[model samples]
Target: MDVEKVFCMNGGLGENSYTQNSYLQKKGSDMVKHITLKSLEEAYVSTTPESLGIADLGCSSGQNTLSTIREMVEAIDKTTYKFSNITPPEYRVYLNDLPTNDFNAVFKILPDFYKELNTERHLWSQKLKSSIYIAGYPGTFYGRLFPDKCLHFIYSSYSLHWLSRIPPGLYDKEGHSINKGSFYISKSSSLQVSKAYLDQFQEDFSLFLQSRSKELQSGGRMVLILLGRRDRTHVDRGNSFLWELLSRSFATLVSKGEVEQEKVDEYDAHFYAPSKNELEHEVKKEGSFEMERFEMFEIEHYSGPYMSHGTAVARTIRAIQESMISQHFGEEILDNLFENYGNLIDEEMGIEEIKPTSFISVLKKL
Candidate 1:
């Protein structure tokens, strides 16, 4: 199935909702605030549009998107002070995601967001000032969403790892999954399995660049805060094996009459973690954008008030992966699956969690 049709973060403001479970992604946005601010500085000083067009691509709804937008607006405000000729920017904000995403959930929270924005505006200055207007764009980012040369800035966070579709060549001559038992590109996989995934990312990411190249005005910049890997040479085992534990959970059901082994065999997560070198290479190959900055850093996972280390880890994984997994493995398996997955984490790991590497990149449209 295409990720566009099936994938989305857990919706609503419930405990399992992405809004509650996305602590690490929130931290990611905070860690990369400098990149967003820098991009705004360059974009405003160069283009200086009276109204800035900003698109937050793959913008999963939660409390986070609004704060990020506020931060960007603050960045724009800071930029305006340095330029005497430049007036305060009126922001046209576009929040985009797949059509299946929970846009209603996103929209439902807007009154509060507007109140906060108004409060901030009043606090920032007593004078009549710039304004922000937000709209929803429901579509995948692998293709163009906006008209040519309109968007001045684009931001995507903890996305871009999702391929537009499952990698081709996953099934063999007999039409069975060749990547049996492995849900992702594991260290032990054959070169063919690895190459299949690499090819898909290459094609999808190139198409992404091509699409955005058409949308961004000259000097327009994009800041992508992404999930990535540490080693330039390999998809590290620690990074790729989260799904491995989940698959083992299915194995317990396969032992009974609960799930077919074939179902387990056919699971592929439709996700890939690329290294910084691969991103740079793709940008060079596309030739439509130049890389301004690329930094990879690590984030340590943790437990919180609502859950333990193992439970928090499982919830975090579920918020992103549950919909897809439920579609394939049956929703009935979800509770048990996560329970066993959490148990596995407790047995193998301790209080301290391994840090997952993430990347922040800034690219300028040529």
Candidate 2:
């Protein structure tokens, strides 16, 4: 499905804007530490690699990899220290993301990892005892992101909902589907669009679980963190406030002749929010792993205070498209969307901060 081109549509996590942006970095740093701590606790209970093979799927390229790897190495160290008699094994860690990502960022970090390894070796007889082998790969996760049973541990964050691509049937010469059966297609009411995204997510996630089941060792583990919705009712999918805002906003766009009526009616995904139940349902369908832990919590996503609602609106949209602002929305359309967001946010009921709930789930392969 030309995943390379589609996945490459966005600059990947390496885009200089957010890839290196301070806001995401700070959040990710904390998130990875928490993730590894949990994964390690689980791994300690079940599996000890005579040699360990770990992977960070959709890892992107940057300091984030270091956080996970460091935690992994530490966990192994602590475990070996407690066991004393068992020799710590060689470690092979594969860092992965889409093909178009900046591998250079990963390569640049490797020398530093090894240099520290060598330095530590001399200071203490078995310091940083494991032999570390790090490599990078570019591939779509939907279809065998790695080799069969090749990984002992896997981790991914903030990347699962992105479908390999927007669904083909939904996009026409103008845009994508708006209303199908019970789906909403308005700019502010993009339930149909969000549903499309959810469908694609289910498809992709199911495939991910199936692939991991094949690629993960019998006792391997996986952890994923993603934005999710709180509502579990069938009707709630249609009632998401974010979707409603987007639908109404787009409806305004169509009414004012600012955006194509058909275009607004056709496509969805102004914002994608999925419920935990939906995610759990898909993962269970894969039948490859036992769910060890699932936690959902709300985090205030602040773009910071802006001078005015319009400025805030601009900042908000820019955050999403900073890397490929021109590709997804042409200059004029993007400008219009921002204006709409500003106007909408300033309205009495509009939200200044997006408080989406994100979830972290951990699983152990049987």
Backbone atom clashes (below 3 Å) for every candidate: 0, 17
For residues 1-366, write the lDDT of model 1, one tens digit per residue: 767888999998887789888887887788778878888778877888988999999999887888898888877786776667768878999999998888888799888888888788768765427788999999999988999888999999988988888888687888777788888876667788878888899999999999999999999999998878876655554567566777777888888778898888888878888888889999999999989988888766564676666687788888999889999888998888888888877765764455567889999999
Best by TM-score: 1
Error of 2 at 15 (Å): 9.4
Candidate 1 ranges with C-alpha deviation above 4 Å: 82-84, 232-237, 351-353
Question: Model 1's lDDT to the true fold?
Answer: 0.83
- Taking all chains together, each candidate's TM-score versus the true structure is 0.95, 0.76
Write the residue-wise lDDT of candidate 2 on 209-287 in tens digits. Answer: 8888998888778887766677753333222444445555666666778766655444444234568788778878878
- Residue 116 displacement (Å), model 2: 3.7
TM-score of 1: 0.95
lDDT of 2: 0.62
Model 1 CA lDDT for position 118: 71
Q: After superposition on all CA atoms, what RMSD does each candidate show versus the true structure?
A: 1.8, 4.9
